[model samples]
Target chain A: MPWAIAAPNTPPPPTWGIFTPGTVGQFFFVIVYSAVIYWLISRAKAGMPVPEIRKIAGLDAFDEAVGRATEMGRPVHFTPGFYAFSSHTLAAFSILAHVASLCARYDTRLIVTTLNATNHPVLEEIVRQAYLEVGKPDSFNREDVRYLSGYQFAYTAGVVGIFHREKVAANFMMGWFLGEALVIAEAGALAGAIQIAGCPAVVQLPYLVASCDYALIGDELYAASAYLSKDPVMVGTLIAVDWFKMFITGLIVIGVVFANLGSKAFMNFITK
Target chain B: MRRQLPVWLGFIAGMLVIIARYFAFPGFTQVQKTLDNWAMYSGAAAFLMGMINLTIVHKTNIQRRRENWGASLVLLIAMFGYFIYGLFTGPDDKLFVSIFNATISPLGSAMFSLLAFYMLSAAYRAFRMKTLEATILLAAGLIGILGNAPIGAAISPWIPSARNWMTEILNTAAMRAVTIGTALGAYAAMVRILLGIERSYLGGRGD
Candidate 1:
């Protein structure tokens, strides 16, 4: 049998030359999906009254965490979950910029440790700019921005060490965390620091939920920076995402009903 | 211009990567491959830059006699020593691999095993039956664990079936929802950057 249905004993036909045929549906949606976001962004930019977006508690806690750090006279620690450039890391950086600004405004020390060699300079620059934007450039300490290690577990261990040694007041974890998430998050918890963690890695949610005071579950992590910044364009993108999700969820529920009622038509239609 | 250049470059490069995926244009793949090759080279250069940065930071610490500066010294030695050794023997050489295995393998395992204890702690906290939802979650988790364990078969024949059903049905459904939501969220974020709406990642740069 062939991978999705074909004549028995027949060699699989040549792959589709145009439009990665198997993925055309998803590809088409990707375009439509971005278009929807663009449209919403435009609307908001035009001063349209966008509906109030749902509150993400993890996001709401960001300033609170930063404030706590300031009050406690301890530094704030930030690590974007994974290393290198990806959507997860990119999203995480958005939050990092925000957190850095908070640290700068409060004149509290900020420690950023990274495992990705490429992101190191960019992260540092972001923090520096954040301080400069807040008119506190001289207060920014280059030494506090660390490139811990290129190794995953080594970075985790180093972060744990920072949590203990620095006695961090607030811990922010966001990005593409893998197996090292729990090790680091637990360290933050043990240090009695207020923690807000978010990652695209679904399996790591349990650890974050248990250890962190607030956990950005799933896409909430992605929506975080937009949610925190409250810029019209960013908020518009979020509004678009939420609307699209509702639409997709409706389709899913209907498709499920049809599937249960003995119909493959919806599946075939979507897959096509 | 400084800010605008990165936005334009990112948009063009990202679109090219996306286009190269679905369209098998004659030279598109080659162009994409070339771009990727350039990225890898840049990443290697970045690695060197990172090493230099690490050295500078630690050297300052040592000079200042800062707290735990000895650890910084050891870190520098280990880092540069490994770098020199790897340069001489190549990354895949037996000695290099042996050293890597001795260091990373066990350390990674230790970190991974720490997950078990952390998981237990997390589970104990999360699985508390504080509310109806928590109780249901606890039930589902217990069933999932027992179903995977050998003892489930010994405990009750129906338990395994229940666990399998929950995983194959409920767990998969929830996971699908999460995966799709994340994909869309990521997609929106990508579009935002492409459109230059989310330019903070560009570090307070241009329109």
Candidate 2:
């Protein structure tokens, strides 16, 4: 035992070799980050100051899109993008509920297309409930909530076909769209439908902007439901998010200045 | 009750996985992994459910002599061919891969490319220089496009530099704001789901 201590040269086990300061530090950082997110949410319920959101042009066009359909005497085509289960999809679903309710109130025909078969029953129910809530239960059409093919391109083709055949006056595309964003938007354009598109796919934003009358770029897609429905929790969360953003921006500014001055100690302390 | 049981189980399983990932507990992590494996297997099995549903629909279409009868026949043949190919030659076989790559890939690309033409037409028809906002959008788009292109750089280095600055500084700030807002919204939605307040997923009647 004395000889082993004196030597003090043997490497640790292969798995434990990298169990150094950096590894320990990173492990702790993740824990702290997660804890902070949890704490933020807990404290957020108490209420936060509302952040002033600059007007989103895409949202202002919602009424215009609906009005166009009404004027044209054509049904509104609303596809909640391709995602059926994601957070983006849920946001889209919430928006769909609002839009359906509005359509019911306006006595306008609403056509919903789902790329996924599983989404059919849920979407049908959503439409039914929305219509009932608006005192227009009879306006809800089972045939309108059609489930097209699950094949991505096939679904796009089917939607485009419908747009051409029905001459949909207004087209609302919101959720997790991919390459099909431009294709769908273009079809709506060809059909003379006033198109409003919202997708988190940044790469596809250019296509949407070029094709659709109104495009909700990136994160504004998430704000669609909140803006439409004015839910307290939704609005409160939006405010909390702004506070978080402000905190991040302040940290970035301070960090930049400190790093420029070569204050390693201050930088490390602040980062920690 | 069947749906409710699954939903409850899903909620419990989801919470356990999150906790396991956060806490670095070996036992919890193992449980989470096991549950994930089960889910993967179940997902594979669920493919049969979809296949069955599709078959039923196509069969009905054929029996009723629906409007798209020829399309139904083509679909049935393709499906059966796919199944036979998988059964006899395996999924990694050259024939299967070649057919998929040849048929599906090009069709997908062609479909996606349709957007470009549509965009040009849409822009021509809808993008009127009517309001101040519209003017601003048109200007920003033009600048953004020019900045990204090689032609802009060839004409003047300042165009590319300006584009870089706009993308890095202005766009980054805007994007960050949106990300924060989205994250908060998602967090709120997750809370609603956890508390069983958002029962839209459960369809109607709330169970």
Candidate 3:
């Protein structure tokens, strides 16, 4: 019989299988994020009436707090809350940027303490940039940006020490805080620092509200950047997010109505 | 030239990462992976910078014979001790494990427990019936706190049920409203960052 040509039964490389799905998903997420971001930017540029953000008592007090520090001639302590790399921290950074600018403009010393070593460089950059923006780059002191420690309590202790020693006139805590929130807040209070604290951590909010002169509750922290910048993209995204919330609310209402009527189908649909 | 290069690079890299995330293109995906790796490494590298900054400040204080040199010495010792322990000892080592469990763990727990006392004091101060809002907040907080504790259940069976109802109906609703509002705000800010309208992050030198 003539020689038969056999087809190769070799399997595709395992590497290909591993690479494909992850890459695709990542790509998809990035594109969606970009599109939303772009839409927001365009809206901002077009001068869309950025929905008026309700004045947060905490944010309003920021100026007063800074002014108090200036009058007292004491350094203002600012700790951008715990998570160094999170979006919340970035938002906090934006607020810090603005606050730093205010500090520079007022010719007051601002002391920023970072919990994580990794955050130090970024924070230093943020402070420097803020000063530069305010036309006081020369006044941006490297000593003012301190790295306390990575450990939570260690960081808190360091901050409290700074509070007492420096007699911080104002304290701004913005970011992802846990139990240390109250410790720092209480310390600030004891130091007679006009404290403004903003964090998304629900548990910490009450503590902040109680001890701090001003408390940015829940989502107000997220709104800080947009509120400070008045950037259009931020405004547009805010609108879109509201729409999303409405949809969620509608769903909740429907589910509640069906549950009350004892509709198994509706209940099951919601439970799923 | 220095400033412009960084700006362009940041813009291009940022867009690439975003696009790569959105699309399934291999090239884009690779770029993103590379960027992510770079971010991780860069983040790690920042530790050295932080150490340098810390040392500089503390050393300067010591050299200047600044006030509270004793505290600085204690801090330096503690830092070095922790670093040495972490570096040298494996988790399997009894001494290391005990130190972690007994000393570190308890200290952390104690710090967290400290909040309870502060919170009570702070709440007492904040919940003064000064305004209508304050009065409502006080009432809600009282209910919420009682509901969460065991004493509320022991005091009255109905109290727990009432607390549960309040949490489910009122607390949930209020929290949800806040969440929605925050989500919107966050989305807006993210959009600004992506569009490069928020270049204040790049520093004042714009590098």
lDDT of 1 by residue, B95-164 (tens): 8889889998898788778888887877787789998977997998888899899898899988899998
Question: What is candidate 2's TM-score against the reference?
Answer: 0.75
* Candidate 3 Cα outliers beyond 4 Å, as residue runs: A1-40, A47-51, A231-244, A254-272, B1-39, B81-103, B145-156, B204-207
- Ordered by lDDT, highest first, the candidates read 1, 3, 2
- Residue-level lDDT of model 3, residues A38-119, one tens digit each, is 6755766787665554566777777898999999899899998787766678777778888888899999999999987777
Q: Estimate each model's TM-score.
A: 0.92, 0.75, 0.80
After superposing candidate 1, which stretches have Cα over 4 Å from the reference?
A1-17, A257-265, B150-158, B204-207
- Predicted candidate 2 versus true structure: per-residue lDDT over B70-143, tens digit per residue: 78788878978888888899889998899989987898888877766776675664456787866766766667
What fraction of the true interface contacts does model 3 reproduce?
0.55
| Best-first order by DockQ | 1, 3, 2
Place model 1 in a CAPRI quality band: medium
Candidate 2 on A84-123: residue-level lDDT in tens?
A: 5677777677667767777787888899987766566667
Instruction: Identify the superior model by lDDT, candidate 1 or candidate 2.
Output: 1
lDDT of each: 0.85, 0.70, 0.75
Better of 1 and 3 by DockQ: 1
Ranking by TM-score: 1, 3, 2
